[model samples]
Target: MPKGSGKVLAQNKKAGFDYFIEETIEAGLVLNGTEIKSIRQGKVQLKDSFILIRNGEAWISNMHINTYEQGNIFNHDPLRVRKLLLHKKQINQLRVDVKRDGYTIVPLKMYIKDGYAKLLIGLGKGKKNYDKRADLKKKEANREMARAVKAKNQF
Candidate 1:
Protein backbone atom coordinates (compact mmCIF):
# COMPACT_ATOMS: atom_id res chain seq x y z
CA MET A 1 0.00 0.00 0.00
CA PRO A 2 1.00 3.61 -0.47
CA LYS A 3 1.84 6.01 2.31
CA GLY A 4 -1.19 7.30 4.23
CA SER A 5 -3.31 4.34 3.06
CA GLY A 6 -4.70 2.80 6.20
CA LYS A 7 -7.40 3.08 8.83
CA VAL A 8 -6.82 6.74 9.66
CA LEU A 9 -6.90 7.70 13.30
CA ALA A 10 -5.99 11.39 13.23
CA GLN A 11 -4.80 14.04 10.84
CA ASN A 12 -3.16 17.46 10.97
CA LYS A 13 -5.32 19.36 8.51
CA LYS A 14 -3.57 22.67 9.08
CA ALA A 15 -0.29 21.26 7.84
CA GLY A 16 -1.43 21.59 4.24
CA PHE A 17 -2.40 25.23 4.66
CA ASP A 18 0.79 26.19 6.46
CA TYR A 19 3.40 24.34 4.46
CA PHE A 20 4.17 23.00 1.01
CA ILE A 21 4.71 19.27 1.37
CA GLU A 22 7.49 17.91 -0.80
CA GLU A 23 7.62 14.24 0.17
CA THR A 24 5.95 11.85 2.57
CA ILE A 25 7.42 8.97 4.57
CA GLU A 26 5.69 6.23 6.50
CA ALA A 27 7.09 5.47 9.94
CA GLY A 28 6.20 3.26 12.87
CA LEU A 29 5.61 4.50 16.38
CA VAL A 30 7.05 3.22 19.64
CA LEU A 31 4.01 3.20 21.85
CA ASN A 32 3.36 1.72 25.27
CA GLY A 33 0.54 -0.65 26.11
CA THR A 34 -2.08 1.83 27.24
CA GLU A 35 -1.11 4.24 24.51
CA ILE A 36 -1.90 1.72 21.82
CA LYS A 37 -5.19 0.91 23.47
CA SER A 38 -6.22 4.54 23.44
CA ILE A 39 -5.17 4.91 19.83
CA ARG A 40 -7.20 1.87 18.87
CA GLN A 41 -10.18 3.61 20.45
CA GLY A 42 -9.63 6.61 18.14
CA LYS A 43 -8.81 8.90 21.02
CA VAL A 44 -5.69 10.46 19.55
CA GLN A 45 -4.87 13.96 18.43
CA LEU A 46 -2.10 15.19 16.11
CA LYS A 47 -3.04 18.87 15.94
CA ASP A 48 0.15 20.40 17.26
CA SER A 49 2.48 17.47 16.88
CA PHE A 50 5.83 17.81 15.12
CA ILE A 51 8.83 15.59 14.41
CA LEU A 52 12.35 16.33 15.61
CA ILE A 53 15.59 14.60 14.77
CA ARG A 54 17.91 14.29 17.76
CA ASN A 55 20.98 12.14 18.29
CA GLY A 56 20.32 10.56 14.90
CA GLU A 57 16.86 9.44 16.00
CA ALA A 58 13.46 10.85 15.13
CA TRP A 59 10.97 11.67 17.88
CA ILE A 60 7.43 13.00 17.83
CA SER A 61 6.30 15.57 20.40
CA ASN A 62 2.94 17.12 21.31
CA MET A 63 0.93 14.17 20.00
CA HIS A 64 -1.88 13.44 22.42
CA ILE A 65 -3.21 9.96 23.14
CA ASN A 66 -5.94 10.00 25.70
CA THR A 67 -5.52 7.61 28.57
CA TYR A 68 -7.39 4.35 28.30
CA GLU A 69 -10.45 4.43 30.53
CA GLN A 70 -10.16 0.86 31.74
CA GLY A 71 -6.59 1.28 32.93
CA ASN A 72 -6.35 3.01 36.28
CA ILE A 73 -2.70 2.66 37.28
CA PHE A 74 -1.16 1.42 34.08
CA ASN A 75 -2.18 4.34 31.88
CA HIS A 76 0.47 6.13 29.89
CA ASP A 77 1.04 9.86 29.82
CA PRO A 78 -1.28 11.64 27.45
CA LEU A 79 1.39 13.86 25.91
CA ARG A 80 4.54 11.84 26.17
CA VAL A 81 7.19 12.12 23.50
CA ARG A 82 7.12 9.06 21.27
CA LYS A 83 10.04 7.73 19.29
CA LEU A 84 9.67 7.15 15.55
CA LEU A 85 11.12 4.02 13.95
CA LEU A 86 12.97 4.90 10.78
CA HIS A 87 15.98 3.65 8.92
CA LYS A 88 19.32 5.35 9.57
CA LYS A 89 19.45 6.37 5.91
CA GLN A 90 16.04 7.99 6.13
CA ILE A 91 16.98 9.86 9.29
CA ASN A 92 20.13 11.22 7.74
CA GLN A 93 18.24 12.38 4.62
CA LEU A 94 15.62 14.16 6.72
CA ARG A 95 18.26 15.76 8.91
CA VAL A 96 20.12 17.04 5.91
CA ASP A 97 16.97 18.53 4.37
CA VAL A 98 16.04 20.25 7.61
CA LYS A 99 19.50 21.70 8.24
CA ARG A 100 20.51 22.68 4.72
CA ASP A 101 17.25 23.51 2.91
CA GLY A 102 15.16 24.99 5.73
CA TYR A 103 12.62 22.20 5.48
CA THR A 104 10.52 21.08 8.42
CA ILE A 105 9.30 17.63 9.30
CA VAL A 106 5.61 17.68 10.12
CA PRO A 107 3.26 14.92 11.05
CA LEU A 108 0.57 14.62 8.38
CA LYS A 109 -1.51 11.62 9.42
CA MET A 110 -1.69 8.77 11.91
CA TYR A 111 -3.26 5.43 11.14
CA ILE A 112 -3.25 1.71 11.77
CA LYS A 113 -1.98 -0.74 9.18
CA ASP A 114 -1.38 -4.46 9.43
CA GLY A 115 -2.23 -4.29 13.12
CA TYR A 116 0.47 -1.68 13.73
CA ALA A 117 0.31 2.03 14.35
CA LYS A 118 1.83 4.07 11.54
CA LEU A 119 2.50 7.75 11.12
CA LEU A 120 2.79 9.60 7.82
CA ILE A 121 5.24 12.46 8.04
CA GLY A 122 6.05 15.02 5.38
CA LEU A 123 9.01 17.11 4.41
CA GLY A 124 7.63 20.60 3.91
CA LYS A 125 8.69 24.17 3.40
CA GLY A 126 6.81 26.99 5.09
CA LYS A 127 4.39 28.87 2.86
CA LYS A 128 4.22 32.64 2.60
CA ASN A 129 1.14 34.77 3.23
CA TYR A 130 0.61 35.40 -0.47
CA ASP A 131 0.77 31.72 -1.23
CA LYS A 132 -1.96 30.99 1.28
CA ARG A 133 -4.19 33.67 -0.20
CA ALA A 134 -3.67 32.35 -3.71
CA ASP A 135 -4.47 28.82 -2.64
CA LEU A 136 -7.69 29.92 -0.97
CA LYS A 137 -8.73 31.81 -4.06
CA LYS A 138 -8.05 28.81 -6.25
CA LYS A 139 -10.00 26.54 -3.98
CA GLU A 140 -12.96 28.87 -4.02
CA ALA A 141 -12.92 28.96 -7.84
CA ASN A 142 -12.87 25.19 -8.03
CA ARG A 143 -15.78 24.93 -5.65
CA GLU A 144 -17.77 27.39 -7.70
CA MET A 145 -17.07 25.52 -10.92
CA ALA A 146 -18.08 22.24 -9.37
CA ARG A 147 -21.33 23.72 -8.15
CA ALA A 148 -22.11 25.11 -11.57
CA VAL A 149 -21.43 21.79 -13.26
CA LYS A 150 -23.55 19.92 -10.78
CA ALA A 151 -26.50 22.29 -11.22
CA LYS A 152 -26.29 22.03 -15.00
CA ASN A 153 -26.27 18.25 -14.88
CA GLN A 154 -29.33 18.22 -12.67
CA PHE A 155 -31.45 19.90 -15.40
Candidate 2:
Protein backbone atom coordinates (compact mmCIF):
# COMPACT_ATOMS: atom_id res chain seq x y z
CA MET A 1 0.00 0.00 0.00
CA PRO A 2 1.10 3.54 -0.63
CA LYS A 3 2.25 5.59 2.33
CA GLY A 4 -0.59 7.34 4.25
CA SER A 5 -3.21 5.86 1.94
CA GLY A 6 -6.57 4.89 3.51
CA LYS A 7 -10.25 5.06 2.81
CA VAL A 8 -11.25 8.25 4.55
CA LEU A 9 -14.79 8.19 5.87
CA ALA A 10 -15.10 11.68 7.32
CA GLN A 11 -13.06 14.80 8.11
CA ASN A 12 -13.74 17.84 10.23
CA LYS A 13 -12.66 20.71 7.95
CA LYS A 14 -13.80 23.23 10.51
CA ALA A 15 -11.40 21.83 13.06
CA GLY A 16 -8.47 23.67 11.51
CA PHE A 17 -10.34 26.94 11.20
CA ASP A 18 -11.55 26.84 14.77
CA TYR A 19 -8.45 25.70 16.56
CA PHE A 20 -4.66 25.72 16.37
CA ILE A 21 -3.77 22.05 16.20
CA GLU A 22 -0.61 21.21 18.11
CA GLU A 23 -0.38 17.43 17.83
CA THR A 24 -2.32 14.55 16.34
CA ILE A 25 -2.71 10.98 17.63
CA GLU A 26 -4.24 7.97 15.96
CA ALA A 27 -6.75 6.02 18.05
CA GLY A 28 -9.06 3.08 17.43
CA LEU A 29 -12.78 3.36 17.79
CA VAL A 30 -15.05 0.95 19.61
CA LEU A 31 -17.62 0.51 16.91
CA ASN A 32 -20.44 -2.00 16.58
CA GLY A 33 -20.98 -4.08 13.48
CA THR A 34 -23.75 -1.86 12.16
CA GLU A 35 -21.70 1.24 12.88
CA ILE A 36 -18.81 -0.12 10.87
CA LYS A 37 -21.13 -0.93 8.01
CA SER A 38 -22.48 2.60 7.99
CA ILE A 39 -18.98 3.99 8.11
CA ARG A 40 -17.99 1.89 5.15
CA GLN A 41 -20.93 3.43 3.32
CA GLY A 42 -19.49 6.92 4.07
CA LYS A 43 -22.19 7.83 6.54
CA VAL A 44 -20.15 9.34 9.34
CA GLN A 45 -19.97 12.96 10.50
CA LEU A 46 -17.17 14.41 12.63
CA LYS A 47 -18.03 18.09 12.57
CA ASP A 48 -19.38 18.17 16.08
CA SER A 49 -17.24 15.52 17.64
CA PHE A 50 -14.85 16.18 20.54
CA ILE A 51 -12.65 13.82 22.53
CA LEU A 52 -12.47 13.65 26.31
CA ILE A 53 -10.16 11.68 28.52
CA ARG A 54 -11.76 10.31 31.67
CA ASN A 55 -10.83 7.59 34.12
CA GLY A 56 -7.69 7.00 32.02
CA GLU A 57 -9.60 6.30 28.80
CA ALA A 58 -10.52 8.48 25.84
CA TRP A 59 -14.13 8.93 24.76
CA ILE A 60 -15.48 10.71 21.69
CA SER A 61 -18.84 12.43 22.01
CA ASN A 62 -21.32 14.05 19.60
CA MET A 63 -20.06 12.18 16.52
CA HIS A 64 -22.88 11.03 14.30
CA ILE A 65 -22.77 7.78 12.37
CA ASN A 66 -25.96 7.29 10.43
CA THR A 67 -27.51 3.86 10.74
CA TYR A 68 -26.89 1.39 7.96
CA GLU A 69 -29.76 1.43 5.51
CA GLN A 70 -30.09 -2.35 5.48
CA GLY A 71 -29.66 -2.71 9.22
CA ASN A 72 -32.55 -4.19 11.12
CA ILE A 73 -33.62 -3.61 14.73
CA PHE A 74 -30.07 -4.39 15.80
CA ASN A 75 -28.91 -1.05 14.51
CA HIS A 76 -26.66 0.88 16.85
CA ASP A 77 -27.56 4.35 18.09
CA PRO A 78 -26.41 7.01 15.63
CA LEU A 79 -25.22 9.50 18.23
CA ARG A 80 -23.80 7.23 20.88
CA VAL A 81 -20.61 8.21 22.68
CA ARG A 82 -17.78 5.98 21.45
CA LYS A 83 -14.69 4.80 23.26
CA LEU A 84 -11.24 5.52 21.78
CA LEU A 85 -8.38 3.16 22.45
CA LEU A 86 -5.08 4.87 23.19
CA HIS A 87 -2.03 4.02 25.24
CA LYS A 88 -2.25 4.92 28.92
CA LYS A 89 0.70 7.27 28.64
CA GLN A 90 -0.78 9.04 25.63
CA ILE A 91 -4.09 9.52 27.38
CA ASN A 92 -2.34 10.94 30.43
CA GLN A 93 -0.40 13.42 28.30
CA LEU A 94 -3.56 14.48 26.47
CA ARG A 95 -5.36 14.98 29.78
CA VAL A 96 -2.57 17.20 31.01
CA ASP A 97 -2.58 19.26 27.78
CA VAL A 98 -6.34 19.65 27.87
CA LYS A 99 -6.19 21.01 31.41
CA ARG A 100 -4.53 24.15 30.09
CA ASP A 101 -6.91 27.06 29.39
CA GLY A 102 -8.34 27.27 25.87
CA TYR A 103 -7.10 23.80 24.95
CA THR A 104 -9.33 20.89 23.85
CA ILE A 105 -9.19 17.62 21.99
CA VAL A 106 -10.84 17.58 18.58
CA PRO A 107 -11.56 14.76 16.17
CA LEU A 108 -9.82 15.62 12.89
CA LYS A 109 -10.38 12.61 10.66
CA MET A 110 -11.89 9.14 10.55
CA TYR A 111 -10.78 6.45 8.17
CA ILE A 112 -10.29 2.75 7.66
CA LYS A 113 -6.71 1.60 7.99
CA ASP A 114 -5.65 -2.01 7.56
CA GLY A 115 -9.33 -3.00 7.71
CA TYR A 116 -9.84 -1.31 11.07
CA ALA A 117 -11.58 1.91 11.92
CA LYS A 118 -9.19 4.62 13.06
CA LEU A 119 -9.62 8.18 14.27
CA LEU A 120 -7.05 11.01 14.05
CA ILE A 121 -7.51 13.24 17.05
CA GLY A 122 -5.85 16.61 17.45
CA LEU A 123 -4.71 18.48 20.52
CA GLY A 124 -5.67 22.09 19.81
CA LYS A 125 -6.21 25.47 21.30
CA GLY A 126 -9.46 27.24 20.44
CA LYS A 127 -9.06 30.20 18.11
CA LYS A 128 -10.61 33.53 18.90
CA ASN A 129 -12.86 35.41 16.48
CA TYR A 130 -10.02 37.70 15.46
CA ASP A 131 -7.79 34.76 14.80
CA LYS A 132 -10.38 33.25 12.47
CA ARG A 133 -10.74 36.53 10.60
CA ALA A 134 -6.99 36.83 10.21
CA ASP A 135 -6.75 33.35 8.80
CA LEU A 136 -9.44 34.11 6.25
CA LYS A 137 -7.69 37.28 5.18
CA LYS A 138 -4.43 35.44 4.76
CA LYS A 139 -6.13 32.75 2.69
CA GLU A 140 -7.70 35.35 0.46
CA ALA A 141 -4.35 37.04 -0.03
CA ASN A 142 -2.77 33.75 -1.06
CA ARG A 143 -5.56 33.06 -3.51
CA GLU A 144 -5.13 36.44 -5.13
CA MET A 145 -1.39 35.93 -5.44
CA ALA A 146 -1.87 32.57 -7.09
CA ARG A 147 -4.33 34.05 -9.53
CA ALA A 148 -1.93 36.89 -10.41
CA VAL A 149 0.90 34.42 -11.03
CA LYS A 150 -1.31 32.27 -13.24
CA ALA A 151 -2.32 35.28 -15.36
CA LYS A 152 1.26 36.46 -15.70
CA ASN A 153 2.38 33.00 -16.83
CA GLN A 154 -0.27 32.99 -19.57
CA PHE A 155 1.12 36.20 -21.12
Q: Number of the top candidate by lDDT? A: 1
**lDDT per residue (tens digit) for residues 13-131 in model 2:** 99999999999888899999999999988999999888888788999999999998999999999999999999999999999999999999999998899999888889999999999
Name the best candidate (by TM-score): 1
Q: So what's the TM-score on candidate 1?
A: 0.97
Runs in model 2 with CA error above 4 Å?
Answer: 1-5
Model 1 C-alpha lDDT per residue in residues 1-155, reported as the tens digit of each score? 87899899999999999999999999999999999999999999999999999999999999999999999897899999999999999999999999856589999999999999999999999999999999999999999999999999999
Question: What RMSD, rounded to one decimal, does every model reach?
Answer: 0.9, 1.8
